[model samples]
Target: MSAEFDVRYTAQLARLSLTDAEAAKFQSQLSQVLVYVEKLKQVDVSGVEPTAHSSEMNNVFRADEPRDWFTSKQALSNAPRQANDLFVVTKVIE
Candidate 1:
């Protein structure tokens, strides 16, 4: 596709308003990117595995385990209002 066509089509897709000079600028940049993509397509990758990222990754989160936490009385100690060991707030739904 022509760079002009690509620029105009992309701007339309993104709901962008571009002046003539801005469109021309983007057309040039888009052409360069397309050229680089074409160059990348020529590289040999028969032995390389496809991956989502370039580096090894492992889960960084801690394992889920049971732990002691605040009791009902301690949790409700700072409540502005409470009834029967439960928080009291304005009813949201009619």
Candidate 2:
């Protein structure tokens, strides 16, 4: 079955350049993976529930609420350089 799955042709399809040895190695690895997947099919999953994640997902974000915002002076206090109530970053373009 692994022989039928041509690694060289698949690599070409993906525009990948693989040496003969590399292709052979990948072929063996892919075959082992497929075999494992096939073995998984033999397991009885009738009683198990299908789930997208292994653990429950909940939003980690804090609730949006109106609060006292920073003043312009407070905001610019930590800046290394400031002019006209704005941070003065170094010129990036000529």
Candidate 3:
């Protein structure tokens, strides 16, 4: 299909209203992209395996370890209102 036709069709599908100048601009850009894609098709990759990423990836998380628990007084220090070592807030359920 012609690049101009493809541009107009895509714009229609996307619900975009493009002026003649904008359509022409997008047509030129789309033609360049199609040409680059065609050029890429010429490259040989018979021996290369397809990969999701270009580089090797590994998990970045640190090891989990046990730690001391905070005292109830310390935990409730920042509470706006506390009763019986527990936070008190407006009831959410009706």
TM-scores of all candidate predictions against the true structure: 0.45, 0.42, 0.42
Top candidate by TM-score? 1
Tens digit of lDDT per residue, candidate 2, span 1-94? Answer: 5557888888999999899899889999998887777877788999898897677986679879988999999999999999999999989998
| lDDT for residue 37 in candidate 3, whole number 0-100 | 74
Which whole-number lDDT from 0 to 100 does residue 59 have in model 2? 65
Ranking by lDDT: 2, 1, 3
Residue-by-residue lDDT tens digits, candidate 3, 2-82:
343578788999999899999989988888877777776778988988898767886678769977898999999999999
Name the lDDT of candidate 2: 0.88
Off by over 4 Å in 3: 1-5, 12-15, 58-94
Model 2 spans > 4 angstroms off:
1-4, 12-15, 47-49, 58-94
What is the C-alpha RMSD, rounded to one decimal, of candidate 1?
A: 10.5
Maximum-lDDT candidate: 2
How high a TM-score does candidate 2 get? 0.42
Candidates arranged by TM-score, highest first: 1, 3, 2
- C-alpha lDDT score of every prediction, in listed order: 0.84, 0.88, 0.84
Compute the lDDT of residue 30 as modeled in candidate 2.
96
Please give, for residues 1-94, the per-residue lDDT of candidate 1 as tens digits.
3444578778989999799999889889878887777777778998998898766986678879989999999999999999999999999999
lDDT comparing candidate 3 with the true structure? 0.84
